[model samples]
Target chain A: MSDEVKDPKDVLICRCEEVTLREIEQAIDEGFDTVNDVKRITRAGMGLCQGRSCSKVIARIIAQRTGKNIEELLQNSYRYPVRPEKFKIFDEEESHE
Target chain B: MGMSTAYYLTLQGKRVLILEAGIFGAGASGACDDMILFQSKKPGINLELAFESLELYHALNVDLKHDLGFENYGGMVLIKDQKELEIMEEFVQQQRMYGLDVVMLDEKEMRKRQPHISSRFIASTYSPMDAQIDPFHVMYGFFHVAKNLGLEYRKKTPVVGIEKQGNGDFRITTQSGEVFEATQVVNAAGTWAGEIAAMVGENVPITPKRGQIIITEKIPMVGETNLWSAEYLVSKLRPEVKTEISEEHKALGLGFAFTRSFGGNYLIGSTREYAGFDTRTTMEGVNAIVKQAVSYIPLLKDIHFIRAIAGLRPSTPDGKMILGEHPDVPGFYTASGHEGDGISLAPITGKLLSDMMCGAPSDSRLEELSPVRFAVVKGEQVQ
Candidate 1:
């Protein structure tokens, strides 16, 4: 909430995708307004871990850059199998037949 | 829908083989919030189809002999403000026109029905037709019965290619190089229907509208009926209507829908984002869902959201489903693009498609649902 200019490049924004603050800032500068928008353009929150690990960090960076509350930023919806599961589970269940 | 179609097809003494691109219920069918509520439908054919589907759900467990974990505990739509309450007044009238048994409840009556609902709600609507089921179990039951009746289903066998044979039959190939020739090919591919149609040289306008849901850890029951916000009705039924809150919520694609699973866990959702195929969850989506849920049910603030998942509702340009045969492709038919209503409309879709394939009297609804409704053959405007 302070006006002190800090280096956005020094920090990591999305740990899941290994996206840095500099990349996130560049994504914002390129006209990505929302968190989901930045994630799509820069792959900041899209990763194997499903963004649960680093989405908040990315949101905060966007909130700071946009001078808006983090609540105003849009979040990407999570996809299925919240964690990784084997595809063989699909085949394994059929063996019950 | 595919499994149910197989069940009906087998009953009509036809050889049926189901080729699933993934495990059963792995798509929208599995990821739904288990709302079989008639209150959600718009009036006219939509409500009539929903009422018909409700009747089918009543008989599905007995017919399948699978129990299905079905429950008719009823449901409620929470109205947060006067604007949303006004919308519900008209929505309830439309539902009533279709003979739905629903009653509007003020804060006192609503509180009597579900005391845990936050005091912010001015009114609510309750309906007995609103119910819940384990979506996976429903498909599994259909598959189990259809299988016993000599139906063959192959999971993970996606249709990689669909070539029209000279004899007017279709040769379907899987990703693993397995091939089979069929007299007719049904495309019940759900959200992937667009891609499947492309394989057969057809274009179906299906957008993967991503919806996110959160499952809280199981606990003692908080309310007796499934609860959704009137905001949800506006979002689903009338997204173009704008207000200050609705406009703000639209940015996050947040609509408040919540239901308790049969196991006592709360399944809270859901955000409608046109994010293409990216189903991964975002921090803002989760936060907005939590904020919407806790705003209506303050008690949920303490609950732990143990799991989060998303499903792509196979949305069409218009809200109606895409069904029936390809106009140009002789043996190719489609039964996909049910969107959020896939779970509710599955039985009806299956029965309808089966009747058409059996050369029986096609349900009048097929006239509207046919894939040619998009009219790519005539090279006309796409709906």
Candidate 2:
């Protein structure tokens, strides 16, 4: 009757760029006062889809670590070329074929 | 003067229907590792052309650089095993062949660049030219830009059928029973290209490879760059390598990878399963991914997992994209099967497709990506 993930190992927060709870705590211990610093060191939420999936959990980890509200320190990182179309999909031309 | 190509036709300021069965990025584009990767191409995979596409992306910074969430976030790959080392070597050579500015660093250099890596990880290949992007946001940007440019979009509208008109134009029927006529058509439907193409009496070989991934709660900044176990890339090539055991599927352990997304979250994945439309996650798969990830970054043992999700890569027979119009059909065109390059390759596709529709020539060499190579042409129709 519990919705919580059973195995502590499988209890993932971010889906796109895999990061873990223990690692978040460790980041906090290392004096990472903010979410961006944690991200800079851990490389979480840096994958294809970016952090749309993992940012909140990361904020929670930062909050728990710094005893600071997540909203105060949570930062957003944006990168470009959002879609990596399949190779052949990108260069479709009618001329060569 | 008028542009006859589909993209041009729509932009030439007319009604254009972009049929989506679901929301934006819900298809193959939604289900990708989304690496704006230009360094991982094979020796014969047209690395030069891929770089050119990256350059096109660079030029789009005016629009793409906006909170479209674009960043300089460089790319880095970790070397954990011999098999991966081989692939990295090949990748380095391919990049170097085109006078690319990528460099392979030794263990010390890698550690210098990525201090978050476990002491065990010895080397890395860092390419500043590679960057990351968010898929959904970029698509939204493209949709808005296209719409502003006068393109009509039909969301939640799936094109169930297409009929060849006696004239050069074609009839496209939507699942909603809405029928439309156009002189030109483009199939950018991602994984459904095979079935979508069948509507026009053509064949597009597309395989839907599902990549399952899991993220953890925010981990400390472990690495400034993306850390990938070359082993997974090698395993993608040679699936017989020995990896940890998994209970769900035999391939889970070997199919694992770790990458830092642009949002400061860790992405652990991914098992490449052939399960059609089955996007569910499994314990065995998650275990395998965690095990492999910890081997390089021992700190993950303390972190918690967030969730598991899958993205479908529009894999093609040739590991290349199928672009341009049909060789045989006058109006039907294709822009699908980008295995994992959908996010990285979109800007390039938009411009090229636009140029093709305008009957204007592209500065980039695309002889290798012509869509007609995959299909046989029949008779021509008058426009």
In TM-score terms, which candidate is top? Answer: 1
iRMSD values, candidates in order: 15.0, 16.3
Place model 1 in a CAPRI quality band. incorrect
The alpha-carbon deviation from the true structure for residue B297 of candidate 2, after best TM-score superposition, in angstroms, is: 1.0
- DockQ for every model, please: 0.03, 0.02
**Residue B160 in candidate 2, Cα distance off native in Å:** 1.2
Q: lDDT tens digits, residues B1-383, model 1?
A: 78878888987888999888865566787667887768888876667777777778788879999767787778898887887888888899878877999989888988988998777778899997787787766876787678778998776678899899888888989999999999998888888888888887788889898898877765687778888778767756666767556565686677788887755667889988888888677766776777777777777666666567788999888888888888888778888777778777888878878888888876775688788877574665434
**lDDT per residue (tens digit) for residues A30-96 in model 1:** 4455766566455565454556777777778778888878876646555445664332333344578
Instruction: Give each model a TM-score.
Output: 0.78, 0.72
TM-score of chain B of each: 0.95, 0.86
DockQ of 1: 0.03
